[model samples]
Each structure stands twice: as C-alpha cells, then as structure tokens.
Target: MENEKHHIVPYRVYAIVLLVLVVLTFLSIAITDIELGSYTVVGALLLASIKSSLVLTYFMHLKFDQPYIRIMVGFVLAVFIAVVIVTFFDYSFR
Candidate 1:
C-alpha cells in the first residue's frame, strides 16, 4: 500500500459531468410529456442507465480505479442488465 498512486481529478471534469447529468434529467422529465406508450418506459430507463454510469465512473472514482475493479463493475452491470432483460421478456411474452 505504500507505493499506491493517488489521482487528482480536475474540478472541470466534475463540473462537466454534473452539467450533463442535469441535462439528461431534464430530458427524461420532458420525455414523459410525449405519448410514446410502450417505448416511454424504455426511454426513461435508457437515460437513467446513462446517468448512473456517469455517476459511477466519475463521482465514484471508478474511472481511476485499477483494471480489476473496473472489470468487476462491468461484470456486475452485465448481470444486472441480463436479469432486467429476462424479466422484461418473461412479462412481455405473457
């Protein structure tokens, strides 16, 4: 642990990410006004996923973590997505 390197992220990057998050939030809210029916939940969920990823990568400092940590996060996310898809399909077919 003595040789561990520390990373200093610029405030500008955080600001940019925050701005993007806010914009996406508003976009999601605006999307509810449209009557897309079946696709509406999908759109909201897609935006939510993007926002969560940004929060994880930047806010949680996952981007600067070791490769193994990032890979683990990716694996977990993949499993979560698979479960969601399977559940969606199960309900959809019925």
Candidate 2:
C-alpha cells in the first residue's frame, strides 16, 4: 500500500486567521450598540459565518481536502439550516 501525504498548515496563515478572528470578535461587540435595525443581526451572522468558515477551512483543514468531505459538510450545514428555519416558523406561528 502506498502512503498518502497530507498538506501541512503554515504558521503565518494560522496567525493571520487568529488575528482576523480577534478583530471579528471585537467588531461584533462594538457593532451591537450601533442600532442598525435588521442589518445588525445580518452583519453579525455574516461575520459569524466568516469566522466559522475560517475555522472549518483552516483549523479543520477542510481547505486542502477531498470533495466527499465538502459534500458531507454541506449536507450537515443544510440540515442545520433547515432545522433553524423550521424552528423559526414554529415560533413565529405562536
């Protein structure tokens, strides 16, 4: 059997991602008092998604990965989103 090699993550990229995460955290907190109406939540969610993507792609090493892994991750995200939507509908009806 042949051995496969996995790509190693560089320290610089990790440091950059960490810095971005920190900045995002600060932005999320600072923006909470701005009163931007619906845009506030949307901005927070967008930032959170970015942060999650960074963590998933780098820390989880999904960036240098196979299609099957991406498919699985997409399916999981779909299920989670569906559940959130259903829950929101249920709550809204009440």
Candidate 3:
C-alpha cells in the first residue's frame, strides 16, 4: 500500500475548535431553558448536529483527509440520518 501524506493542522485551529465546541455546549444547555414548546427538541438537535459536524470535520481530520474518505463519510452519515429518521417516525406514531 502506498503511504499517503497527511495534513498537519495548527494548534491554533484546534484551540479555536475547542472554544467553539465549548460555546456550542453552553448554547445547547441554554436552549433547554427557552420556552419553545415542541420546537425545543428540534433546536437542541440542531445545535447538537452542528457540534457533531465540527468534531467530525476538525477533530477527526476529515477536513484534511482524501476525497475518498469524505465520500465514505458522507455515505455513512446518510445512512445514520436515514436510521434516525425511521426511529423518530416510529416513536412519533406510538
């Protein structure tokens, strides 16, 4: 197998990502306090999704990885989303 060159991300970028993740965590916590009724769950889910994407992109080095890796990640994410949707649909009906 051929060795692939990896991109070295700067410490500053990780620091920024950490800061953003902290802020998003706080935002998710604060979101629970708001009186959005049924939308509160949706709001929290949105924030969580953003946080997950940030972790996946930066912390997982997906942002700097090869295109093939990104394609595989996309496929996996699509399957995950589909499963989540089906689970939620089943829950909503019951």
Candidate 4:
C-alpha cells in the first residue's frame, strides 16, 4: 500500500527499553532473595508482566501495528489473564 508508511522506532528507545528490562531482571532476583511473605510472587510476576509487555510492544512491534492487531492482542491477553486467574483461584482454594 503506497499510503502506508514504514514505522521507524529510534535506537534510543530500544536502548532504554533494554536497560529497563535489565533493571527489572535484577529486581526480580532481588524479589526472590527478599522475605516478602505472600507478596513476593505478586511483585515478581508484576515485574515479569511489565517486562514481557515491553518486549511485546517494542520488540514485537505491536505498537506500530494497525488498531485491529492491537485489539486482537488485547483479546488474547484478556483470555490469558482470565485463565491465570482461574488457575490461581483453584490452587489457592485447594
């Protein structure tokens, strides 16, 4: 399509995202070492989710994709989240 233009993300953005991912990785290790009671898993998972989202948004180039693609990704994410919640509830209750 001649009307569609290529999306060019700057190297600087990638570098920053990489640095953030590294920091989050270290934080995840720190979370494992700290005595956070029941919150440790939550914190680690939150960081992991953030890191994964960054990777998906930038590395996967989802941010530059069409709205329909983003919607599909959102739908998939919702399903994944629902499954995780159901699994967590089942395990916690048992």
Best by lDDT: 1
Clashing pairs in 4: none
* 29: Cα error in model 2, Å: 0.9
RMSD for each of the candidates:
1.0, 2.1, 1.6, 1.2
Model 1, which residues run further than 4 Å from truth? none
How much is the lDDT of residue 61 in candidate 1? Answer: 94
Evaluate all candidate structures by whole-model CA lDDT and list the values in order: 0.96, 0.87, 0.91, 0.93
- Candidate 2 per-residue C-alpha lDDT over 11-85 given as tens digits, one digit per residue, 9 for 90 to 100: 999999999999999998988989998579768877887899999999998887888999999999889878877
Give one digit per residue, the lDDT tens place, for model 4 in 1-94.
Answer: 8888899889999999999999999999989999999789889889989999999999999988899999999999999989988988998999
Name the lDDT of candidate 4: 0.93
User: Which 10-residue span in candidate 2 carries the lowest summed lDDT?
Assistant: 1-10
lDDT score of residue 10 within candidate 4: 94
Q: In model 2, state the lDDT of residue 72.
A: 99
Ranking by TM-score: 1, 4, 3, 2
- TM for every model, in the order presented, reads 0.93, 0.82, 0.87, 0.92
User: Which of the two, 1 or 2, has more TM-score?
Assistant: 1
- Evaluation by TM-score, superior candidate among 2 and 4: 4
Q: Which digits, one per residue and each the tens of the lDDT, describe model 3 over residues 1-94? A: 2697867889999999999999999999999899999789888988999999999999998887889999999999899889988988998899
